[model samples]
Target chain A: MARVFMKGTEAIAEAAVRTGCRFFAGYPITPQNEIPEYFSRRLPEVGGVFVQGESEVASVSMVYGAASGGTRSMTSSSSPGISLKSEGISYCAAARIPMVYVNVSRGGPGVGSIQPAQMDYLQATKASGNGGFRMRVFAPASVQEAVDMTYKAFDVADQYRRPVLILIDGVVGTMMEPVELPPMKSDEEVAAMKEAKKAWTLTGHKLDYAHRAWIQPGNWSTKVMQSDSEEDAALYKSWQKEAEAEEFMLDDAEVVLTGYGISARIGKSAVKILRAEGIKAGLIRAKTVYPFPYEAYDHINYKKVKGILDIEMSIPALFVEDVQVAVKDRAPISTCLCSGGNIMTREAVLTAARKIMEAK
Target chain B: MELIYSRTKTIQEDKVSGFCPGCMHGTVMKLIGEVIDELGIIEKTACVLGIGCCGLQMDYMAYDNATAPHGRACAVATGLKRTNPDTLVFTYQGDGDLASIGLAETMSAANRGENITVIFINNGIYGMTGGQMAPTTLVGMKASTAPFGRNAKDHGYPMHMCEILNQLTAPAYLVRTSCNNPQNVMKTKNAIKKAFKNQLEGKGFSMVEIVTSCPTNWGLDPLKCLDYIEEKMLPEYPLGVIRDR
Candidate 1:
């Protein structure tokens, strides 16, 4: 594939159109608004439905209804807008509706700022809804990955019968990088995707004349209905194992650093700097945050590894908690956090790792 | 023996409704379903249900359906109809869902004359959320939230949604009928059929505000519920065609 330079938002929108997405509904918000604007002009040319909804709530529901009708649907929003769509996302999860959601996070506790920050780590990974239903989250670091993650999000959503989110921070969302998009599927492939909906859609119940009678259930019954089969339960159980991450320079190390999203990109530079100082340090970057990839910790020898540094750009040390939980009995963990728009640099992470190593 | 019943002609049987027993929602659903069947547009029809007892209409009917959030059926229907212009779109809402929380959405859609049908069911109380006072709850009517009755000094009088809707020139057909008695049931059916017919004729936004009963929430039996809707609610919200533009 010939790689071409593109922004993260553009890649996601283009990849969506490539991967059977025929309906795009969204409201304009910072970091993610570019996606809707890009699709608004391009989607119509391909005979796709693109609607700029009146509100985030309506935008998410538009995707919900369109997906319910057996069309591939998607929507995008930033922090505050994503907060507004939580109710709709919950409903889609409860109904096991297959849809894609792209969240280009910016600094926020409330109307915080539009600059790059990892403030939404907790919101994107946990308590996404009233129910503790887990939404599959993909944290892409670069523009190319953002586009590739969106194209793959639909496949994962369909395969699991659940909602998948592309959780990108403002740094990746706005930055332009090299990307090579695969050729869009032919008409036959698009038709096959629609035809494939029969395996799990509730479009209609085929009945005969002899079975025409109806028995009405109570209102409470609708709440208790079990739409997922035994096979679905088994597939859901294996999702955690299939999730992935990226590892660099972990084989011979005395200290390890863990991060994700834009922070991981910074972590790579820090790893090189620490290696130049003749310190044994490595980096473990997570690609899938929801699955948490617990097995990655087993590769590091806790006895030899003195400590771990978890760096993020959020208040209250959100991502570090995950790192602590993953390496519970193994080593001491420290956090590098920023509340507003201050992103941690390569020098900052390396300095934090050096402090941990010197303390040991 | 004519034996002329064919599965109510419109609704699918297995879905089995979730509305309370003796509730008027069932009658309203059947009427809408029959009208869809009569027009031969079931496949191309899409219904939007708001959050209320009446919104359970989606469970009873088999057309392309969507259950919208509280006060959002009209808004969602706007999107549904605009995207699939060939599909027949309608929004089903109750007094609370349509008149109170969703008032903005309902009025705006009506004002836009967005070619869609809205089956506004005025049951006087929020039945789904435990009988809270709705915007259309009659003054002096006691609900869970309005225990001392909806006071003119405090809560004000019940809103006449049909009259409010009639003020807009966009709606080509707007009628207020009841399902209180056999005679009124026939009138409600005719009103609904006409709403669908208006769409077939490309006549813009049509709505039929059906005066119905919520027996469980009203602290009345099925028969008394019917009597209350006919006597108390109807006198204040005079039953008639508010608009036939």
Candidate 2:
């Protein structure tokens, strides 16, 4: 298929449909509203269900319910809305329901602003909900990455039987870029997909006692709940093999700039400027924030590296906390950060990298 | 005497429900069981269970069910019904779960006319988290949160879900029934059956708000709870079909 110029939000909506998402329920929030708007127009053409949920709470819960019935379900929201959905997301995690949710994050400590920010990295990766269940969080830096990631999210969700989150900031979510959309699934393929879930989905089928996924907590004995937790813990542990990151220009670089989503995109531009000036600045863009891509830091030559510069669109730097963990104090950690809708500019990244050398 | 009807084949016999003794919640669950059985859709039914004591119905309601987090079962039912419209879907929620935290979800599901049934149990107080005042708690009702009785100035008047839902034109069937008395219980069973039948008929949204008893939470015994409903609850949430299209 030929690439088309489309807004990032529309590309995500169409990509979700192409990946066999037949049901979408979402509440409108800025920086992510285009997703539902596009779905309302596009889904009906494909025999898919589109619901503008009254609130994010209802939207995520709808996704949970639809997913339980073996539908390829999805919901999306920004920071404030995602907070409301944390309950249903945790429920999906507990029930081990497979679904995809997108967080086109905006500036927020409390409805802070509608502009882009990476303040939600910790929320997406770590404390997604009350329970310790982890999510497969994809932080796409570009519209192309958003399309590819959103398209592939469904399969990853089904493969792991968990909610996969596409954590893009307002920047990539609203940006227009050429993206090669994946082939759409035929109605027959959608039906077959539902049929494949008959074994575990909440169909009116006569289920035997061994049908684990269909049982709710009300029906679950304490023993069953404990065992399910243990099994899921093992499953989370097994995800390390699937953790991913993109390390750029890091063979012998002394300063590695680390960021994700739009910050990482700017960090790359900053790296290019640094390289042109004959300064060694590499970039490590975290594609999956949950897995942390800790191994990427291991690839860096410790002897050649002076410090890890974390660029974030946040106050006091949130993602830098994870960077601290990955590098483990092997090198000093510095941050170039802003907050309250202040985006991380490439010039800011270069300035921070230069300051790291000045302080050393 | 040969038993003309024993128990609904749809409900499990051996499973112990967590409802407190004398709670009308058991009666509501029985109605659900009987409705599913009489319709011959026991094997083709799925339930979304809301939080609170209402959730324990999944233990004995042998049909497949998903226990949603507090205030989310109706939204969950929307997903379930749309994903598999062939199966009859319903959500069982308590007053606190549905009318309080999940009011928007309940309304949206009804307004969208999603082909799912919602069985709302409006007891005057929150049963799961103790006797906290609920949105449907009467003005004069006493609860843990409303220590001095629900004063209208401080706490708003009880919300009539049936009346509010009736305002939404999308609803195929909306009714306020009860489990307080045998006659009312029978009416509730009939209302539930209608809601289920509507979904099977591919009609839009339907809900049965069954005014139920929370004896333990209401500071009333089993007997007083019935009296409380017949007196205080029924006057506010009158029993009868509000809408049946």
Candidate 3:
């Protein structure tokens, strides 16, 4: 397909539609309104359904319902709205319903700001809701990356029968960039995808108790709950192999910078500037934040690496905890922090990297 | 041997009733099953059950069913019915699940005129979590949360779901019936059948609120609970259809 200029939120919606998503339910929130707006217009044209739910709580629950019937369903919201959606998201995770949701993240901690920030890293990867359920959290840095991740997220969700998260900052959500859209799935292909789930989906049963579909998030018996927990633990452990990261010039660098989403985009530019200034700097960007790309840290040459710098648009840096776990104290770590909707700049990352290199 | 009366095939043959004795959930569930059997929608019908005692229906019904998070059954039904318009969808919710926590969802779905049926059981108090106060608990009704009786000054007044929903223009059918006696039981069944029939006819947002007895929660015997529904519950929640548009 030819490249078309599109906003991040609209592109993500279109990608979901192309991937055979036929149901969408969402509430309007800042930096993410384009998603539901685009769906409200585009879905009907493709014989799909779109509902602007009464609240975030209702929206995510609607997604959960649509997904239970084996339909490709989705919902999107910003930070505060995402908090309201946590209840339904937790239920979907518990019920093992396959759905996709996007967090066009703005500032947080109680309606903090409407501008872009990377403050939802911990919420996206760690405690998304009450239960300790893990999902494949995708952090896309640009419009094209967002489109591609949104396209593939549905298949991954169906393969595991779990929810997938697309975590992007407000800048990427509102920014326009040329993206090559994927081919739209044919109606027959969509039907075939749903047919693949007929074995377990809640389509309908002819009053046959053995084959009837039941979607329950909780087990009444303690024994059953314990067994389900054990199974989920093994499932989460299996995700370690799916961990992914982008290693940029990390073969032999003195200072290694790490981040995800837009922060890493800025950090990459900073690495180039630092290299031009006779500094051996490199960048490690996490594509899947849930797995945290721990193995990517091993590629850093600890003998030659003087320090590691964490760049993020969050105060009291949240993502650094994972970075610390990955690096395992091989070298000293520092942070370049921004918050309250402040966007990270290349100069700030450059300054932080330079200080880390000059420290020793 | 001649066949006289048999149970609806919608109820699983091996599953025993999990509802509390004297509780009317079983009666309502049976009526729902009978309606589905009569309509012959067993192959295409799906039930979205709310949390609490109403959620126990998942184990007994031999059809597609999903349990929504507490107070989200109406929203879930809206999603299911909208996406699969050909599928028969309904929500089974209790008073606390429908009138209290999920009032917003219920009202929104009803206001939007979503073509779905709602089977609401208004049993005055919360059953599964013990006799706690519910939004439909009558004035002077004693509950675990309202030990001093539900004072209108503090706990407000009991909510009439059918009356509240009738105020909305989108609802096609809104009725309140009970199973306190044999006649009322038949009336309740008829009301339920009408609600489901309305959905099948593409009429939007039909609801049948059943004013039922919760003997265990009411701290009364099964027989006395029936009298209680007649004297205490029926006065607050009158029977008959409020709207048939």
Find the candidate with the highest lDDT and give its number. Answer: 3
- Tens digit of lDDT per residue, candidate 3, span A1-360? 899999999999999999999999999899899999999999999999999999999999999988988899999999999999999999988989999999999987899899999999899999899989988899999999999999999999999999999999999999999999999999999999988987666677777788888897988899998899899999999999999899999988999999999999999999988999999999899999987899999999999999999999999799999999999999898999999899998888888898988884
Ten residues in sequence with the least summed lDDT for candidate 3 chain B: B78-87
**Segments of candidate 2 deviating more than 4 angstroms:** A207-224, A357-360, B1-3
User: How do the residues A220-270 of candidate 1 rate in per-residue lDDT, one tens digit apiece?
Assistant: 454444433343455556778966788888888788888899998898788
- The TM-score leader among the candidates is 3
Model 1 quality (TM-score): 0.89
Better of 2 and 3 by TM-score: 3
lDDT of each: 0.79, 0.86, 0.92
A-chain TM-score of every model: 0.92, 0.96, 0.99
In model 1, pairs of residues that clash are none
- TM-score, every prediction: 0.89, 0.95, 0.99
Model 1 docking category: acceptable
Question: Candidate 3's residue-wise lDDT over B12-123, tens digit each?
Answer: 9989878888888988889889988998999888999999999988887888999999999999998888877878899999999999999999999999999999999998
- DockQ for every model comes to 0.30, 0.62, 0.84
Please tell me which model should have the higher lDDT, number 2 or number 3: 3
How much lDDT does candidate 1 score?
0.79
Candidate 2 interface RMS: 2.2
**Per-residue lDDT of model 1, residues B68-152, tens digit only:** 7678677667655655566677888888988887777778778878788989888889998899898888888899988998998
Best DockQ goes to which candidate? 3
